[model samples]
Target: MSRLRRAAGRIWRVASIPLLAIILAFIVAAVVIVVSSVFTSTGLDVFLPLGAYGSLLAGAFGSGTGISNTLVAAAPLILGGLAVGLGFKAGLFNIGVAGQFLVGAFAAAVVGARLAGAPGVIAAPVALIAGALGGAAFGFIPGFLKARTGAHEVVTTIMLNNAAVLLLTWAVNDLVRAPGFSFPRTGDLGHSALPILLGRNVHLGIPIAVLAVFSVRWLLDRTTNGFEIRTVGQNPNAARYAGMRPIFITTLTMTLSGLLAGVAGAIQMLGVIGFYAPGITASVGFDSIAVALLGRSDPIGILFAAILFGAFRAGAPLMQIETSVPVEIIDIIQALVILFLAADLIVRRVFRVRAAKPVISELATVTRTWAGGAPPGGGA
Candidate 1:
């Protein structure tokens, strides 16, 4: 039917943007890798026939352990990407996911380590909830400042990140250090701290990540609250005229975004570290921003993007072991992906593609024709 065809076309068009971005990113990364290898080795032949690319692929996906490690690395990325992507949908910039992540990890560590004699089921949920709440509280500060004082979130969030690093250092060094040790970390969590899945460290966090992706997609696409958030992001004044509260929406979205990021922190602790340390989270929060951008702010795209990042993280060890290449190559590839995705205009211009407006207009005409002159907003 014409209606079906129109719907299919719309889906394809919507899907194409991120697809193009990803393809371009990979191509650019490949070019960079090859060129760099050639320059360092004095010939492309040294790098090309060594099976480096094949080994990289195999190290990431050729065995169960490789796949498990990839999924494990990707777990935090999924939640962090959703956090950044959700904030973008609401037209807010959240650069403090790193701080929020730390707070969440600290909260979970404190709770999981101290809660005595509780069953794993109860203790794990309690710790995770505490972690999420802690992250949400930290996230709420920037949102509140932005809503109340016209403060730029970028500045506040970035400042908060520095403060969080110092505070976490203090906590880990002075208060949470193991009873008899000088190490700047809390005591190891008990069995109850882990989220068991398939007898591996994969943990319950993977399912949580999947659920978070689905929940974010639903919140953005199918809910009234989502509509209000999008409306405000697209046009705040128009949203106000339509009775949507931009400030409330902004605060709520940031809070939820923080909550998700916090969940990432908690899961990282529960699934990987088994305790909190000041440096454990590193820059995953910042990396999430790149992941979200590469995903084009779509949840499904984010899932795949996170996996791609995870694959790089997962394969770094093998890449180092087999090829004597520094693990930093993965970082270089990731950086290139982010750079290309951020400069989307360059890709569009280079491709000489028609602008999005004309494509959208053509789709609209097809949809209108398929509806046989029905009311514009009405479903067929």
Candidate 2:
């Protein structure tokens, strides 16, 4: 009976996270809509039909186009979320994903535009590789500095973001600008870019995003290297004592994290923008950090969280159109989700009262008996 109780407790704890996250998100969304209505003199009447959620569903899944747009938006988020999630598993804060993403977009744009005669099959792969390389290189710098000179990654990454913005702006404005136009953006990537997937502007990057989520799941859960990374993250000193090199692990993890972030940029450039622009990749990388946090850093959780965020992003415009709600309401709700997720101890306290001490002691006895061991006091 005690053994069964413990098993049930474990299951409940595992199930509570997603349930709480969804509930909190809805509650926050409702509050935002109500506030918006009150301020706009509608007093909840304008937020009708679907109540506060009408715009959300309409923008995300009301039509085939909406659903496709959501998926398209989810692509870069998956990549960026994976980058942050992987960094968390290695105990590294990869706040430089924004910079890495910009570097990737620039690199892919330069490579793809130059390869004029190459087929999509060839050009796409080369551009992605270039983006990945650029992102990896950017990530490696902070890792190197952290390992060798004790420079914190957060500061270095944030500084690098400003530098990346300037550098990309210059590159697009001067080097990669289209001949007939004076726009501060790169030349358009032609047919060698991403293929249209749904006969709409949505591209094949959606499938690639799904595959990346599965790949990241497998890598973290099934691979030996992943085990080492987790160990290092949990306790660097213990990992070092167990004959693992912390420095090497840190460097490798950051590199891979950056590579994934870069892929997001490449997909955005090739599939969405078809060109590299200074502000095109704005805030997506930072938003991915929130996605990773809301998902609890689990790969599958991150995928769902990415979709949720994508839905908000896709639906924001509709929310503004149909109701007086500001598009910034979605941002507020996302921020609230991250805040609540980070404060999970409060949720657990409210919803999961601890089992009494006597109950816990009784459960321990049963567990020991099942394990073929005597109870703590020696009597069976």
Candidate 3:
């Protein structure tokens, strides 16, 4: 019983800030709704916020399908959040998940589309590998540059994001365009579709994503390389004194981050789209930054945070149709979550909670990154 209590306390400590942040975000959103109604012809609708939230929650958990939709939407988010979360552990800000996601999905589509009649066992794994390689290759570039040239990852990654979209758009239109389709889309993924789960739209990637969370947790907490990564993130000079190679760890962490994101793209291709198309990412790469911050850069925390974000997405359309509230409200709430996390002191003061900062956080890493020319170990 004592063990159970300790575990519960541990979970609560880790979860308290994010949970409070989410609650505060919704409260603020409610106020926004109440205030906005005053400017409209409807006058002050004090119940507007309650109505909107009702619609959102109902749409997210109202039926079997709603729950399934949440799971399906959450799959890639879990991967994307883990990707960013892992980078935070190593003190690397990987803002190129968008590019990596695109490249991976495209690669998976190319290979999967060619396997016209292959068995699921054979086709699925190969295309997944191609996607992983594609994402890793993109990830490696920035890592290599940052490690060797003292180039900041933020700039290089942002530029690459644009390049990837343009390049993929061209390829989809000209190189791999489906024979019958006039749109900028890739060929059909002939037999590489991931197996559906429980006769629902959910796919193999859902379990894979959950598995990835555990895998990442184990990697960070139960491995020697994990210790080195953490040490480098906390202090590069100290890492050098301990005889660890910061350059290699920097490169490895970024590459691994990309690999996870690439897998996200691959499964999204095989399980969801079955073809690559422009705008397919729908800003998932960007939203994942908020998810990482909400999760405080922990794998387990990322899982819960991703699910919450996914709930918002899965419920947005119905929230719009039912309450006449725009889907953009979801974006505002997400931004608010980030703001609360970045300024956790406000959360602590408001909630009357007392706790020290963790060993690491996405907010800290981001601040250090944007404030400097070169990352610590990578610069030297």
Root-mean-square deviation of every model? 7.4, 8.8, 2.0
- Most TM-score-accurate candidate: 3
Sort by lDDT, top down from the best:
3, 2, 1
Better of 1 and 3 by lDDT: 3
The lDDT for every candidate, in the order shown, is 0.75, 0.76, 0.84
Question: What is the lDDT for 234 in model 2?
Answer: 63
List runs of model 2 lying over 4 Å from the truth: 1-12, 41-50, 353-380
lDDT string, candidate 1, 1-380, tens digits: 99999777666555555567656655665666666667665466445424555666778888888899889989899999998888777667777898888888888888888763588888888888988998899888888776666566778888988898899889888787878656667877785476677646678889999999999999988999998876665556677777777778877877888898899988888778887776775478998987887776778878998998888888878876876566777777777776665555575578754435533443343233233332111111
Colliding residue pairs in candidate 2: none
lDDT of 2 by residue, 1-380 (tens): 99999888865655465557667877877765665666566665534535446877798989888898888888899899999888877767778899998898888888888864688888887888898899999888877776666566778888988999998888777777867666676666775488887858678778887888899888878998888777666656677777777777777888888888888888888888777776775588899988777665677878988998899888878877876567887887777777766566687688874433322332343233234342111111
The runs of at least 3 residues in candidate 1 whose Cα sits more than 4 Å from the true structure, single-residue gaps closed, are 1-12, 38-50, 354-380
lDDT of 3 by residue, 1-380 (tens): 99999778777767788888898899999898888878888789999888899888888788788888888888888998988888878788889988988899999998998884799899998999999899888888888888887688888888988999999988887788877776777777777888897656988999999999999999989998888887787777788888898888889888998898899889888998888887776377887788888888888888988888888988888988987778899989998888787777777787887553563343565678766634844645
